[model samples]
Target chain A: MRTNLMMTAAAGAILATGMTTAAMADGHATDLTLCWAAWDPANSLIELSKDFEEQSGHTMNFEFVPWTSFADRMLNELNSGGQLCDLMIGDSQWIGGGAENGHYVKLNDFFDANGITMDDFLPATVTGYAEWPKNTPNYYALPAYADVVGWTYRKDWFERPELQVEFMDTYGRALDVPANLAELKDIAEFFQGRDIDGTTVYGAAIYTERGSEGITMGVTNVLYNYGFEYENPDQPYDIDGFVNSAGAVEGLQFYKDLYDVGTPPGSSNWYMGENIDAYRSGQVAMQMNFAFIWPGVEADENVGGGNSGYFPNPAGPAGQFAQLGGQGISVVAYSEKQDAALEYIQWFAQPEVQQRWWDLGGASALRAVVEDPDFATSQPYAQTFLDSMAIVKDFWAEPAYADLLIPMQERMHNFVIAGDGTAQEALDGLVRDWIEVFEDEGKI
Target chain B: MTYSPIDRAAAKTPDGVARRIRGLSDRTIAWIFVAPTIFLLLAVNIFPLIWTIRLSFTNFRVNRPNNAVEWVGLRNYERILTDPDVWNTMQATAHFLIWTITLQVLIGFTLAYLINKKFRGNDLWTTIIVFPMMLSPAVVGNFWTFLYQPQIGLFNYVVAFFTGVDPASFSMIGDVHLAPWAIVIADTWMWTPFVMLICLAGLRSIPDSIYEAAECDRASKWRQFWTITIPMALPFLMLAVLFRGIENFKMFDLVVQLTGGGPGNTTTLTSIDLKREAFEKWRTGYSSAYAVILFVTVFGLASIYVKALNKVKER
Candidate 1:
């Protein structure tokens, strides 16, 4: 009887200690770490996060890696179950891996408890960035940025009378924003090796970067419009015809043609940064890049003002589509300060905060902000951003996305840049590679 | 009793500790001294190697820890060996290895021979030659990209000057045919001095008496070079080859920063390919198998080379 009484008291004391610790934790301030790629938007986020810091009385630390190494570094951190990041703005392609590997906290319940609705966000952003099974209501993250592949052109040069007349005489069309990929090609060809202000300029700076995801991101913008589907709509993983369709081959060839006859010399391995440099330095008349660079181009001394114009990727034979490029913010499963991280998400999802995010150079995915009546006229590229997002298609968001991506990068680079094999052969090889991957994954 | 500082220090210890120390055997004391190093080796080196070998037969992914692991003996090895792309990468590596070694050795030996002539500004020339070696491989890779740039690059301009070709017509890193050579040239430029220093050491170690004796025997300079210098420095030359061969086989950063294994895998060395498999693809077990194959190839070749080196030394 005495032993039982002592045991009960000990248990009660332990319970009291637990409650006290929990209460103390809830009352105390936390140092939350948010990880993302170091870019202009990340800087804007830093400025915006200061408000959250003051409101919550919690410190916010940022770990921003460069675009090239961000995935490798951050993914490694997540896979190792490192507690470095309480919040992560991970790439969209990582959604499947993040959810499957339990690197991200499932936000469905969190959203319910916090009155955060996915309906308030853009459908494409939700589908691309938040949902793992894609289009399913199952949520792993909240859409943080809305970005898509878009074009920036030398509007000043396009408006020039001599160039316009010459372009019209050559292509038999007004040199305006290309209504289609064919017209875009004509523009690119017309601008190739043209003299502008005593400097020889090239047509465009397209992504041909071999490392990481640059080329894949660039090529897919063409591929999707040319009827390159990831899989058959009726049958998941049935991609033989869909991936290597005749239209897809044409798309691949078109991209290769643009690469060969359009881009500047030594642009065989260009990416976003390289393209930006090419455009800013007047080496190229047009640049294909993500919409996020629009603001930077608008602010640049050389390419800024009304000199540059933005447009969504022009239509192709099959349809109009752009490659999606954005990330979603999620609470890392390994984080100890998940409550604080969730609070931050709740605060970020507010309409007012999202409006401020847009104002501060963030590509806010909130429909409440983007769908506002004044949003289209907010910035010169705002309408282009909207159009691009509407037509955005993303790469495979499978758990094996890296495997899928690496092969595509190799095949695309080999065919397009290395001048190896035919376009059909390249796409066929990719099909075989992806099939093997799917077989290994037991998804075939 | 008179004692050393260590002994005095030991003597100041508590009686129980002192007694225990005195009770230990010489072997135990030796083991006590070596235990930490042994433990470290086991933990850092031997353990991982053994673990890697064990993992080679399984289908385990590091990123998908929740997934079930399955044993698939020799499958990864078979796939790697039979894959044409793998073979292509191997060919690229071979091309890199052969060219870099041959070029570095030839140029290095020549430079070392010239420097050993002990002319004016010899130290200055040697220091200048070694500057490229002193810089980080990553830095060399980065700057060389600029140098190899098509239009504004000094290298392209120099080539154009010699060949009378347009400066902007060809891209060293952007063309498949030239990308391999681009990495080779950059690597040779950066690492040639390392080989030079080794050859210089070897050259310096040879005594003047040997040359004097050769001259006394009515041997010509060419004969002395072929007979005395070549034979004497064979081991060092072999040593330099062995080091450079191994280093070039695992070359990653310099080439990666230069071409990123492109113009479509023209410069994709096995190290870069293995990195893609291991980290980017997260195929841990498959990459472990890949690593094992590489380790065995390197070990077997190095063993043969070392045997030859020992024989040369004996001669």
Candidate 2:
């Protein structure tokens, strides 16, 4: 009787262990939620995650929101203790605030434990958006995608012999893609009234959105090019001389000139989507946008597919600079599935997986993958983005940076649309605003 | 006196019961009935307002909620008053409000008068006219933006036919000089019907006898309109002005879509500027102060308006 009882107990223990193992094999998480901005690339990320689930035996859920409401929605979710998302592709600007508020996991320890070095990613890609401060080791996120501003123009229009001859004769120079602000202005003026294929096209469409980050992103390229620094080099928060420099004013006037002479009427409200539409419909000659639109522009029947060409922003007197705009993959601090989330990041970072991401028309932050000849050869615009990445710069990423940016956006819109004040007046206003914010925060 | 004791005792019994019921004062009973509403008001309206007022005194940021909030006293208020940007936005808001209100009242009242005539297809015309207001502001803004497009927009095509300016060369929203007007035009299109509907109700309420009396007096059509129609419609017109004034004062969404308060800042109104300060900038304290200023201004205006409305009613 004792022997029989022992055998039955052993059999029950064995069955229990088998069930636990089966559960473990299924996944640590029953389901996972991922959030990102609404776009074609976001769709591509979702598609890529399907392979992750297939490999790991987990399910993936996604919440994609439009760019306009992206920050507000995420802020609401964080404040309300909404657990709808386990992993989020957050804007780089949110890192400081997110970290301070305990909204995101401090991934430094995780990276250290996993043997991941920051060197694996592009310097600017890691430092610009993902790092809280320049060259800081404390990482709240891993670089998912890197998007920098670049110019897109119609090669067909530029190649027209008659137009080229006319532009050369009028400007006393050959119109081989503008290399500086003066040439850019000249090119815009030349194309302002020109009819192409019986449809009138404007010279350029730069973002000037008021409600969101559109204007800030568009104007920063010019501001930085024209030597507008947010703070004094040594003092950081001191903005007396740098806020409204002569170069900055020149840049602002140039923008005004372009708007006056080149842009189509009623174009003040053009954001990324509108700009893309305008460019795709052959209504505009050039557009300043991110590499995220490469695939769409390439595949699009109207604007892409052998019609669009990409170049870095023209040089300013201060040198060339483009605003780095992209998101980072972050693990939510409140998420229950830390191990699984880490595993997913590890899986995504694999060389083969990164290659697949590039192949699928997604910009990879991985240096090796992005610079791979095989990857570049497959995609037509890969080299254009790769070349443009060298000159990328990013906006302020402080916790109070959003607050600083708000006034800048307001002032920019005011300067550009209202003509209420000069660029100097606007920048000085921004400096004052920033000083007040910093003083209020006791940061200074 | 001894004979009256029995009568007095009998009177006292009924009088005591009456006094006991009356002792539960009407004001006390009224307070009891309204306690729930008062509590709700405190919870929803009063509490938030008090919080906002308190926040306006401190430097609070939404992004860094846990950061130490400092007492800045009236600095926010002082900054706003001194800031030229704030003043410019106010001027823009005023510009938009004046134009939209003027155009809406004139157009709305005219349409209401015509529709109140019981003309053929009056019901259909009223329905069609009010349709713009029925659509969402975002939707209206989007479609209007499309219409304002210089290249393919139908608006520019019509303008081009007359003005001969290359449609591609002028942007109604992009031009700094014209952006405010663009917002005003879009807002007028969307909200004029609301004013018209209110005015139509007022017009319909006027008795036919007034017109008949005016006709017997041999009053001309123009004279009859000036006397009977104008006096009778004043209340509704004021009401429309009050509503539009309050709404346009806080207008954000349509402008956000239409011009986003750009080509630079030509269309940035007080509300858009406030949003930039509050949510976008995360300067909760500064924005709260802005909100309070707006509230005080609107509140004072509304109070005066309500008094004027009462006086009109008395007339």
Candidate that scores best on TM-score? 1
Candidate 1 Cα outliers beyond 4 Å, as residue runs? A1-27, B1-19
Q: Residue by residue across B162-253, what tens digits does model 2's lDDT show?
A: 99988766778877777788898999999999999999989988899999999999999999889999999899999999999999999999
TM-score of decoy 2: 0.88
Off by over 4 Å in 2: A1-27, A79-81, A171-174, A230-235, A417-421, B1-36, B162-165
lDDT of 1 by residue, B89-193 (tens): 999999999999999999999999999996999999999999999999999999999999886899999999999999999999999999999999999999999
State the weakest 10-residue window (summed lDDT) of model 2 chain B.
B1-10
Alpha-carbon error at A197 in model 2, in Å?
1.6
> If candidate 2 were superposed on the true structure by all CA atoms, what would the RMSD be?
8.5
TM-score of each: 0.95, 0.88
What DockQ do you compute for every candidate structure? 0.76, 0.51
